[model samples]
Target: MRPAPLNPLTRAASLRALARTSPATPLDVLVVGGGVTGAGIALDAASRGLSVGIVEAADWATGTSSRSSKLIHGGLRYLEMLDFPLVAEALKERDLLLTRIAPHLVKPVSFILPFENPLADRVYVGSGVTLYDVMSARVGQKRAVPTHRQLGAAQSQERFPGLAAPYGGIEYYDAQVDDARFTQALVRSAVGLGASAANYARVVDYLREDAPAADEAGAAGGGSDGARVTGARIRDEETGAEVSVHAHATILATGVWTGEQQAAADADTGLEVLASKGIHVTVPRDRIDAPARVGVITRTETSVLFIIPWGELWLIGTTDTPWREDVGLPLVTATDIDRVLEGANAVLERPLTREDVVGSFAGLRPLLQPVDGTGDSARVSREHAVLEVAPGLSAIAGGKFTTYRVMAADAVDFAVRSRFPRSRSRTEDLPLLGADGAQLSASRRSLVLANRDLRAHGWDEARLDRLLSRYGGRLADLFALIDAEPALACPLPGAEHCTAAEVVYAVRAEGALHLEDVLHRRLRLEFEVPDRGVAAAEVAARLVAPVLGWDEDRVAEEVARFTSVVDARLRAEAAETDAGAVEAVAAARPGGGQGRRVRRIARM
Candidate 1:
């Protein structure tokens, strides 16, 4: 069946809905967090005919969701830890995403793991990758991804010229995705399924009804200590409006902020989430001199580094180090960049330098603090745990991107059990917003459609292909924008890959309230471009201003804010020490760019 188009999320309507929540018509489930898992939970609950609402403090994917390694594969390293179940479950989810859930967003990519010890290492790594392929095939879904194969050193170098020569390697298949876009699509899909979702809406505190009088206390669930959580007090970040939303059950999927969310509910649960920082360095693909189609994966002393191929860049990452700083602002320091470069240089034929890096981003992984004294966050299990913090409040934390759907299902299963024990999760078979129209023959159909409608307005095969890949069946919306104004068909100056229509569409269709949402999440210009979308910020703000109802001054302010964020990131990345990077990044905080005086005044 063809899914219905999603409703547009605007500031006015979302705020109005928040103001109207009452005990009479309370939401069946109120989900906190707008990441992949929370969006999945909203979709899961809404598909089963439940009233669901999800709220995010910042723009969608502003946290770890946007700053991932972007792979949708089973962790091969987990297999060495004798964790077969985790690998098997992840493979099944990967298969579902590749074939059914989000085929347009998730595409398969080949990866080669180089080995120095020809005989023993090849036997070990080859056997591991074989098992990985076998587990994926066992999922019973369509094996759209191919199996593993052996590659000689010459073959590996021929496939990937940038790699340092090794004895041999094992080539295997896995899937990659635009993680931020997928998360937004999930939220949109949930909204389409009758779920209410809002970004830039922060939940400050839970609303627990006061204890009844002494006479009525006995009648009301035995005593005053038996009070249950009723709802939450949400603060709208844009307008600073506070509203109370009543819900039957509240689910917290805040990744790194799991502890904070629970504390807001006054729950004294021992759900410790240690924040482990991982940084990724983006370099222009040409500088790496590697194949555009293949990715390189190798083991570093700390963790594995993946050189994944993005559209115009190579994303080389990730150092797993313990982080004790503020989780809200994770800065990519010189040390972080140097660590990544060191890892990449170990495998590349040509060593990468600091100048080779075009962009860098850091994300925090919410690793579950172990009780048995496992110090390494990498060794910690990616399995998530759900805790019933109170009578009706549930919080889940510590899971990988591949198993988000499962985590959502489990969290929702726990949250809704008391109310609707019979309700089962239907998200496994439920496709995302644009999935139904994205068939195997979608490319041929889109080309024909684009030629018919968009040929007159500067759209060719290449432009239509890019739009079709991102929007799937929803390409009609972009076409409509172009039809109204042919100038909207023109692409951005610095980032020609994105059009003005996309920026407008982001504010009007997607829930983009700020310039960062458009540049960082919607268009991906922040990470792809060297200036981090500063060159295109003015154009984007101007294009989206009319749609977003921004005045001349407001447009200028937005552009300035975005530029400051870019400058702050660059300064932080250039800092020599972690402490120095943290200090530099503080300047980009809410009122920081304006100065310490503004921050003090704002706090007052």
Candidate 2:
């Protein structure tokens, strides 16, 4: 089938169509949430020639999806717990992402696991990593990444001179990606395959009863059972307009928000999903004085710590704390940052402080609570579950980021079986939007070098190769637009690696609706920029103004909104407690109604 266009124009039209349907046509599948899993489901079901529509209350990846460690791996630590199946499944998917699915977005990275005792530690960790590599090979997955190797103390020190101890370490491989971009690309790819997807469209309640029927007396009363879900009553956050869209099947992929959606769709389903918070801090590459590496998993008392490399910075994180606080604004508290710094600094010669942290983000993991109430969020299996809560409503949750595709496939399979029994999923071999061979090679160095404008901008073979590797073949399409408008090739005001044209492209082609979306996810300026892209907000907003049809007032508003978010992040970082931090971040978000609701809902 010919790929559908996923540019901004199409997205606007889709949203309009969704808003116009009075009684809403019943769809084959209606996916709530536009994050990675939902996008994946849309792609899976649509590729099978099923009609699919996905609705997100906010922008794509505006939640836990955008905030991740950004690593695509086999969960090396899981091996220690003897969770072989999860590790093996994740490894297979990791390979698929790196080689076949999103080679442009996902690339191999290396990490060093330092040890104080050379002999025992090396033997234990090395065995696990070696087994990890063997499993990847055993799965018939192409080993795009190299195998793990034992490193002597001297060699380890040479690679990471800042190591406190020189006993030795083991180097293992994994992959890194732009998580939000990957999610967007997944949505785009699904759209290209005829899936209907929209953002900022919130599902307030399930349409349980049929519309008033025209019987013998043409009476205005429901015809079907009142309890059975018929569709969803959706609200466009931007316009505050309500509309209903019927569907033959509904799949809830809202991650941490799954339980709430399920209960709204049906009260007696009684699904329990716990939100486990994980925080990541980004420091300048120069701060750590470590080689570009990945998989630096340090064993902790409760969980593992990872000091992974992300683009121009090192992403050190993640505290697996059970947070019962606000889920929507999962702000990284000072305490959380302190914990991460303490864990990561254990082996570092120079410890990282709040001053060294350029950017920090926290994501909530949707863990399924066990019935026995014996397991903690960390121990809850990353294995996903698909539960048919009602006749038309189904909820899927509790999967790791690496295995989103598997989770999506399973969820869609349940939807098909319970709601649309005739449909079959065909996404196993379906390539995403930019997966065509021609598009895959479009951003190659040779092709980029052929462009005179790129050459003029000092894009040598090496630089073009870097761009191609980062953008895959999609870089060609971006460059073509820049060729037509030379001014777009100029680098961002504050960020050197990113160009103004990229910002415009993000708004025009990538569905970037706000400055935060452009800086934080679209180009990663927030992570790469020292000020977290605070200084570049105005410039980025101006670049996207035309595409977004923003007037001067709207442009100023966007800029102000971006600044407020950055300010909130900074304030949250400075807060001493998690509650204060959550309040700070919540106060700065746009649309007071949604932000307050999110904060309240998250706390619940």
The most accurate candidate by TM-score is 1
Q: Worst ten-residue run, lDDT, model 2?
A: 216-225
Give the per-residue Cα lDDT of candidate 1 at 535.
88
Candidate 1 stretches with Cα past 4 Å from truth are 1-11, 139-141, 210-225, 370-382, 439-460, 587-604
- TM-scores of the models, in the order given: 0.91, 0.89
- Model 2 TM-score, 2 decimals: 0.89
lDDT of each: 0.78, 0.73
Candidate 1 lDDT over residue span 1-604, tens digit each: 3333322344556567766889788889999998888888898898888989889887777788888899998888999998999999998899888888888788889998998898988899888888898887754356778888898989888888888757978889998988888988888888777777778788988977654443232332221244567789999877788999998888888888888887778864536788888999899888877776699998899999999998778999999998787777777899899999999999998888998888888888988764232111112235777766655676778888999998888888777765688999998887777775554355775667566565655566666666766887777787788778878888787788788898888887778877888998888876788888998998899998876778999899888888877888788888977678778867556663445212211010
RMSD of each: 4.6, 5.3
Q: Name the runs in model 2 displaced over 4 angstroms.
A: 1-8, 19-25, 138-142, 210-226, 293-295, 371-382, 418-424, 436-447, 458-466, 586-604
lDDT by residue (476-579, candidate 2, tens digit) is: 66777777887776767888677777788787777767677788878776567778897888888888888778999988877776777677777788787778
In candidate 1, residue 325 scores what lDDT? Answer: 72
